[model samples]
Target: MTHSLEEHGTEREGPLSLQEIDEIIGTENPPLRNLRITYAYHQLAVALARLLDDRNATWCGFGTWASRTAGLFIRGELKPRPVGLPPVPPWVSRHLMTWAAPHVGSNVARGNLLVFQELGPLFHTMVTAYTEEDDAERALERVLQPLRPGLVTEGGQDLLIAAARSYHRAMPLPHSAARSQVILLANLQVALHEQIRLQEAIAASLAPPLRAPFTPAPLNVLATRFWGRLATSHLMDVYMPAVDFTTTRTLIPLRLGRDVGGAHGATTFCEHLTDLIDLELKALLYDFDRSPNSVLGSAAADWSLLAERMNYLTDFFRLWQQDPCLMQAPFTPRQAEDLRAGKMPSGPPL
Candidate 1:
């Protein structure tokens, strides 16, 4: 089925106003709604590009960080680290990335890169505007000139939806339903775990002065959470409906099977992630009584929290880099040899 921006509450006349965009985002359903949010962010990024000096080293560093960070979610590269690392839990196998489609991954990575390159600055501007007692609407409109061409055309939207569906169809089929669920869950968990690690790394790489600009105010924090929810929802609610059935059937039994109890049993990684996303949404979009935190006080908190994890993992990977081992199993002999010789693998493993 074809989807249009109009179906998700955007008007065709000229450009979308902030109110209209908010209403659409507030009321629309998943996948399409998620796509709309992405479209909005892309617009914001464009606006940010117009406002920021591209030649500034700090800005360039931020772009590089954003591109690399986006890669964690889109590229699906398996780390060289052995399984059972902090993010790579015991349940995750080293060969998980083998199941991913490199072409699809590359397309997704490119799409993500387009939006992420300016996202940090976009958020910074929004929050800064709020703090400065500026005309928030005017400031936002200046950055988001919706009259211009959007990042995703209708054809591009169709392609994205189609790509997501293709990724779902290509999911591996194992001998039993249980095995299939395990593989699916493992892939999801590993992707998210690795993403968190990458976030930590990106946050750490920025010097305090450089990172200060990216520090978000309460409004931007809410915006960040909203963007995150929409992104994840695009995968779970829109792209991977099959996940719902699998999660329903497997979650309880899987926990019981492992005899998992206490706080951990209360929620799985996906569940906890979803809950946090929802909580942030509720606080930002719905909660009227929520007290706003000080911008500077909490400015560094988010980055610090993200940076805390993956330190050991970071150190381990750095150590492994000194004497890299030959790629094995999934890699062909030639590919393995090239890797050992410090060359990029020449072609697809297949």
Candidate 2:
């Protein structure tokens, strides 16, 4: 749906600047900007994966120079288009750029995490190679090269970071009841991580001389702490209900017990109990699946474990509402009276 709303997804010939991003992507809003950033991270991940697979790069050490412009290319370009997944719009330009302020800010936070959590470890694991390394230029190349074939082209990464420079500008919270409500809720959770990067950027930009006893790397450390706090906050805090509210509301189901008389009460009870039991069993299985990886630290490995869990649930829940055999109770007399006469009865199920 968003393919055309973009201006460009190319790499700059030289070091990236924010204006170039605004120009290339027409920095108007969130989705367009996020698409750019997400593309960049996806590219980085692939580049690292390639390095991880390389013999010379085995000891960690990859950087921007390794890759170059390929733009929003996907796995299959020539063959007949695949059937299922929604194709990226042919040109994602237009007012979509307006969504960038918040989207870019959010992804930038995650991008920082990807860099520190994933890339930094590669360096640590392969530190011996890093210590002996000389050509900083080659080091950057080595890092970025593997990503050459993936989704983000060199130009694209440059453009995204460039566009992201305007992130400090706030997304004018829309006055519309629908949009503002979402922003107010999402801001609470998202702000914590986003602030992490800002603090670090400021500290580094103003950091003192050659060797002062460091208090910490400002932005990243704060990011680390903020993430710690986020685990305790409920998911409702982190994402706007409206983001996936349609899907979520469908998944949770509504059972108006009071309205739906006693005739079907036993049926509903059995169904809810069965669904919960199944859910518990699924959770247990995933818990076990993660056990082996507890001691093994690799993104691919961790992703594989989590992916299995995600895939399993995605399928299980997709059909849960339409589940053929599941039983549910019918309406009670008062509920039926309200329904027949047309009254908005309160509670989940009707």
Candidate 3:
């Protein structure tokens, strides 16, 4: 049997008052109660996507609702009921009541997805701070306490503890050799610990990953939740193109006749620094997809390594940004032009 927002009896449009939104979702029908609650979550996600785009969106309030509701959902105690939301942005409110559309269960999932996106900025800041400090417990509390409230539902109290465990499982202190010097890299490691917590909360709300018919792709769903746009634009606009000019046309055609040790030298360098960057981005996408349900898997370990690599790469990229000339890598002199290419060397010379 198919269920929908209208069949659940919600008013499509009029005013964006939370009260009106409240009414569309509030009801005594036991059979439709869950559907109503999920619909409310969907509308809220749509509203939030609009607000986040505004430079003046009220994040603190959004954080409050997200934290409390996230806590509720995590604890499995979320009631299909109205929420005491902070006042909606006047412009947003003005149009919300006039808003009407077909809705689906995935909207609720998208709402949860938006919560992930909305929380990202705060997450970045918190992770930065968490990684710098040596004391784990103190750092965890310093960050966690601010978000904690008396109303955090079931199992919410244990989230930080679980994340901390995952952090240690993946990243033991005293730092790995690869992670020792770079603070940015270290910060990413610390940040993942917190990300684990957020992922856990979301996953608890969306288990087994159900997909509604004609729903958006998972990456698109996540991207839109955060940026209200597609992933391609988000990545391309924000990230520099992955290219390694040092190795550009580094490969040469030799009919056993081309001058030996000439041009790119006898050494055949088939790889470019860009390849590493692309690999990292791919790894990141993989991690993002897995993060939803990765409380216990090898995700912690994978993130730990990726964070270290990202740190080093970030520094490398930033250095190039400061002085573009810094990226002109000198070609290595190879002794013999062997036809068979060997294993691509790992780790940048940086």
Candidate 4:
């Protein structure tokens, strides 16, 4: 039977008053602190998205976020719910949300997915300062901290924001593309880890590989709980088409391509970076659909890696969807050819 948060009960619209949002999803959930934090970020995201000129795009992000929240509180599906979120620009938020819509599920992974979207992929960035073990998550805390609101901010060691007095300036905020790129890439990294965890759980549960670790038994029918949260960052190709690492003469530490050669330069090299996404997804599907060699063929695994891979792929595409930079690719192949042979940005003809 199909279930939906919107259909489950009589839903209420806000002015929910802070207490209401808090009470419905309150500490009754595990990872309670994080869920409260996610809801808080969603509130901030809603307010911020309203400020953008492109309201539809902004609304997209907010809607996905709210739906995810409702899903968590209602708790029907199997995926984990998100706890807290970092600030994400409305446009990027829209793209990521759209890309991920198909992958959304209830329960555990959903929550984890949202947090992964809000926070970028530096899953292992050491959280300390000055080599003091006692510092505890300080370095990580700083990175996770939202950007300061101002013209110019420092990221240390020659990294400067160059200030934006207005949004119309040549460069867009890193918060949009940068955040999406980091988050998507980070999710990829963690998927492998989560896969391992699932593997462990599967091994312990039964020797037969064909069975799904989770089935009809619903969780949060189990929350009374809440929980949580990288960066190769391929999304730069999607967001920043004109200004690139090679063009700007900067060494960006991203792992978007395979072997950094051939046609797969960055995700944005093609329209929508669809090729890169398709490739990754195909590989994932192969794993999910194909079975590993076994001496005793004890029923191949069911739930396919496709489920989780699609989840990450959805997030990746969402970031690409909302990028204003992606709205215009600087030059087409013919234009590049003409320019290489000496031509203007307009070139000879279409």
State TM-scores per candidate.
Answer: 0.23, 0.20, 0.22, 0.26
Cα lDDT of model 3 by residue, 1-350, tens digit: 02222332222311133343334234333223332332333333223222221111122212322232332232333222121112434344223212211121233334444443323333333444455667866665655654533222331334333333333332332333221212222223233333443443323222322345676688546533322111111110111112332344132221111111212221221122122332323343354333221121211211113342233323222122112211122111230011001212223221
Candidate 1 per-residue lDDT over residues 1-350, each given as its tens digit: 02222331222212223553544335323323323333334333233222331111112222222333333334344232222423444334223323322422444444443333323333444434434545654554543432223123221232222222222232333333232222222222222233343453333222121123665687556544432222221211111111122123111111111111211222122221222322322232222111121111111122223322222222111111111010002223454344333344455411
Pick out the ten consecutive residues of candidate 4 with the lowest summed lDDT: 223-232
lDDT of 2: 0.25
Error of 4 at 108 (Å): 3.7
Across 36-145, the per-residue lDDT of candidate 4 in tens digits comes to 33333333323323232221122222223333333333332222212112354445534543333323222233344344332222211111221233443353344334
In candidate 2 the C-alpha lDDT for residue 297 amounts to: 18
Highest TM-score: which candidate? Answer: 4
lDDT against the true structure, each candidate? 0.28, 0.25, 0.28, 0.28
What is the Cα root-mean-square deviation between model 2 and the actual structure?
24.5
Tens digits of lDDT, candidate 2, 3-111: 1101111111122223333332443333233233333322332332232221111111112211111111111111211122122231321122222223323433333
Count residue pairs with overlapping backbones in model 1.
Answer: 0
Candidate 1 residue 103 Cα shift, in angstroms, is: 25
lDDT of 1: 0.28
How large is the C-alpha RMSD of every model relative to the true structure? 24.1, 24.5, 24.4, 21.3
Ranking by TM-score: 4, 1, 3, 2
Better of 1 and 2 by lDDT: 1
What CA RMSD would candidate 3 show? 24.4
